[model samples]
Target: MSSGSGVQPKVGFIGLGIMGQHMAGHTLAAGHELHVYNRTRSKAKTLVERGAVLHDNPGAVAAASDIVITMVGYPADVEAVYFEAGGILDKARPGSVLIDMTTSSPALAERIAEAASERGVTALDAPVSGGDVGAREAKLAIMVGGDGMAFEQASPVLRTMGANIAHMGAAGAGQHTKMANQIAIASTMLAVAESITYARRAGLDPDVVLDVIGTGAASSFLLNGLGRKMIREDFAPGFFVHHFVKDMTIALEEAARMGLDLPGLELARSLYDRLVSDGFGEEGTQALYRVYNAIHA
Candidate 1:
């Protein structure tokens, strides 16, 4: 329903992880009927306490709501939630909307859209960027792909969770856009790590260096935000290293499918793979700085 329609759609949210929780929180705060489910029930505790209805499963949430949004972890998880028995596609009523906010395979997004259409349901692949901070502030950049009308209907709900939201094109376009975003981020993260490492190696204050160069030719969101995090050595999970690796893998796989050779992306993936192998997968991606730091030390 459009914001001006005076129709409040019942909203369901699945996957209450680092970003999902805040997004779902924003949806609830906007006064819609909010239903939620997560594998780890405890993660839904605060939201439930805040008047959200916590269901036993994804299907239950789907059956109960008018519009369902899933911000699950992996493509596999997205598959299970939508394609499994008693899943969203199985239980959602005809004419309802399904939005998968997970960063997943473009092919899978297209598959979900086709399956939903067959059942008279509208599906959109609307993956997001902006990490935990963006979600918390309701300032995420959402890239959506699906029917134009469906995007219009979902805009009001999407607005609660993001500041910059766009309907990219048909099914899979949103995911393709996200892959491009990840590819850019993959290499930028490496540069951010290396730049800070070099600054420190030369005995220059990284914060001052940041202040000087942050607005110059080398400026970027990752360089300014994650760069500072790297300088402070705060490796918390704003966006987990493992998750970034997963995005990079998906981008690399897509590139190969399209006959592209992205060497910079490949190099970044290798470094992040090492971080995961070294048991730092749970840390934020800024922890890449530690790898450079250790090498310089």
Candidate 2:
């Protein structure tokens, strides 16, 4: 609860995948006594070498830390980590905090909050954006939803991993906000890919076009960041294509629940689905360019 100098919380981090690895590292570097768990122990090697305590399971991590955070892959993974036998909710001490940073279901976030409350633990759905680079640089934008008091209690620890952090509302609000984020990004991704494809077909240097258009109203994080990655053919998973598809699916489902229609998001999802079908799921979202190329071919 203390945010002052030299105060370090006992923090437990589960999921050491792409962005999680760097986020955990930032927490450890900020002086927290870090406990970590990953399904693949090999992924935690660098953090363990830097003095983090590695645990065999989520429950172990929760048992050992004052605050426990999970940044896993899917809604099912989220449910398993929090509700399975020997899970975090089963082992986390009373009054401890649980933060799920996965872009997951709003319903699931509400479920976790209710379960955590029943057991005297505080829960926050604190999904993040800014991809692998942001995680590595500790500049992620963290959107949090839960009790206001819990958000305040976790602020300093969250600060270690993000530059832009906001408490959206209660329980499921964070996930809803994240769904909104994904919806907006969905259309922009297609646009960015199409724009680059257009520039390339016109025989204008795409990089030069990026320099001009990226400074105009056409600019975006996708344009300035992932655009370069696309231009360089860097299809590595800063944020994977499959993952973005999952996010868009969640957004579409959520929108449907509210009796809304989003044609652009639907189109983006269809293109990403094609990418997945063609074996580019593990590639970065910048692989949207491949879809454009395939279409124009």
Candidate 3:
């Protein structure tokens, strides 16, 4: 739909995981007609109680929505949701907007955009950052890529879910931007874990050290937030470890395609690989602290 159409879009959301549930809630709370679906119907129950229409599958959600947002797990899951039989593209209205907010492959985003265009649907790869806290607080950073006009039409709804929203460029640009985000975060996560571990090993109070360093040159959201989580040994999934590993792999693949090598990113990916191999895939990225914690313990 065009910007300034003065119509509230029917919003459909898929993947009601840790982040998506809160995002859909914000949209509903903002007065959109909300439709939703998830593999586990129980996840949609809370939204359904709050006036969202529950659909059984992706295609049904698309049919009922003027704009559809997806926040599924892996690239393969993204493909299955959009390309498999009875998918979003199959049922989306001609002018409906399709947004994939999952952190995924740039190539996959490009493919979805192209396929959506073929169906007269506008698709944006609008991946997000800020984890569960940001999702819950409506403070996410949304990087969007696709049609500029479509981005404008989608911005009001996006603002319900994010404070920092930008139109990066054409198709797949958002995912590329997110890859850059993940690359920077990968090394920082490693450093945050190492720093806190070092503090404990040196017999310093890690929390006080965090208070000191977190205000100085070394401060960041990861340092302040996830570092605190680390100190408490809270390994819950704000952003899952397996998902971070997937993001790192996608970033490294993109880097390899450009004939570039990133040693830090590679090293971080390897450590996360260990976490996944050790069956901590469902845990938060901060669980990396456990590796360091165990070594020093």
Give lDDT tens digits, candidate 3, residues 1-297.
533477789899999999999999999999999999999999999999999999989999999999999999999999999998899999998899999999999999999999999999999999999999999999999999999989988999999999999999999999999999999999999999999988998999999999999999999999999999999999989999999999999999999999999999999999999888888889999999977766322
TM-score of every candidate relative to the true structure: 0.97, 0.97, 0.97
60-102 per-residue lDDT for model 2 (tens digits): 9999988899999999999999999999999998888999999
Could you tell me which residue pairs clash in candidate 1?
none
User: Which pairs in model 3 have colliding backbones?
Assistant: none
CA shift of 147, model 3, Å: 0.8
The runs of at least 3 residues in candidate 3 whose Cα sits more than 4 Å from the true structure, single-residue gaps closed, are 2-5, 295-297
**Residue 16 miss distance in model 1 (angstroms):** 0.5
Root mean square deviation (Cα) for candidate 1? 1.8
Tell me the lDDT of candidate 2.
0.92
lDDT of candidate 3? 0.94
| Candidate 2 lDDT for residue 288 | 91
Stretches of candidate 2 off by over 4 Å are 1-7, 295-297
Please say which candidate is ahead in TM-score: 2 or 3. 3
